[model samples]
Target: MSFSPAAAHPRYDALLAEWCDLLRRCQEPGADGAPAPDPEPYGRDLLGRWGESQRKYHTLDHLQAVLDRATELTAYAADPDTVALAAWFHDAVYRPDRSENEERSAHLAERALPEAGVGAGRTAEVARLVRLTVTHDPAGDDHDGEVLCDADLAVLAGDPAAYAAYAAAVRAEYGFVPDDAFRTGRAAVLRQLLDLPALFRTPYGKEQWERTARRNLTTELELLTA
Candidate 1:
């Protein structure tokens, strides 16, 4: 699915609604029988962060893409709700020039989810899942992690035109970097992805995305090096 930059905020409300529903499921009941704290504000905060000027690829469009893929592969996740939460926070603290974005985003999830009434275990799981995006390398048996990691990478499997658009968006995000520096850095990242034994961890992701992802990566690498 292609995303228009103009529609980002409108689309965020739908994603936020889905997140609120998931948050409600993960909520623990209050001792006095009160409902758990609402997560809409937190969702809005995250959406706002994703809409920042420094972000071009890691916008609401990217979040929605990952969330949609996670929902489609929900049957493969051990905890779909946690995976969904992780998706919301995965790029929450993005900075195109920064290396610690994943760690920072995970920290944000750790700090925010529990206060909003998510259980400790679930909160930890969400943070862990967010951190896994730093490598996109989940353990073989970690189903939820696999699902989340694959979802984050699902854009690699898009059609050629969509993949081209994604590459342009990413380049735009790093517009601060000089052409030579950007090419070297971007090429290194693509090569690392190419070197991975498998790009998609979950069976569903492997079946649906692996080949196309490799093709897209190879195509981009050629353009970068050419």
Candidate 2:
């Protein structure tokens, strides 16, 4: 299940529709009276909220990147819904101060997924995937978590120009700071990324993105320092 960036949006919209239909099918008649809101509008609302957040370097594009990679990786794997749901909600609450972004995002998804027709067990799996993105650490790993983390970091392993664009977009999202602060902070992030044992933890990630990601990081680090 390889995805072209052009076609991914429609594919995702169709998936959202199916998820909404599942909710409607499982609903008790008149439970909420009128009728369920249209899934397109509801999905748009979620995406819009994500877009408008001031602290969004990890915006819809970022989510899409993860989903695209997850789709490719999961082609040879299983439980695609867990990866899909995680991609949608992993960055739902995007505050910079808290280190618990993943936990909060997972909580938001846990509440939202049940309302959107996901089962309790699957919701837990989605939450697990969300947590996986918090740190690229792969020890004591689950297969799904590894896939999700690799997908999240795939941006770093993209083509150099695209990777640089992503790096700039990330800095722009946090552009309230002074130039010096942004430079220092951005440099630190690249250094930390360089310090990683491997940017893509899973074999699929390694195969597809490991080299490109390292190239992007090293190039950016040199540019940032000089």
lDDT of each: 0.88, 0.70
Task: Write down the RMSD of all candidates, one decimal each.
Answer: 3.7, 6.1
Per candidate, the number of residue pairs that clash is 0, 1
Best by lDDT: 1
TM-score per prediction, in order, is: 0.93, 0.78
**Judged by TM-score, which candidate is best?**
1
4-115 per-residue lDDT for model 2 (tens digits): 3323444556545654554454333335565544455446555654565575567666766777788888864457667766777788777665569889988887887667
Note the residue pairs that clash in candidate 2: 157-213
The parts of candidate 1 lying over 4 Å away from their true place are 1-8, 31-34
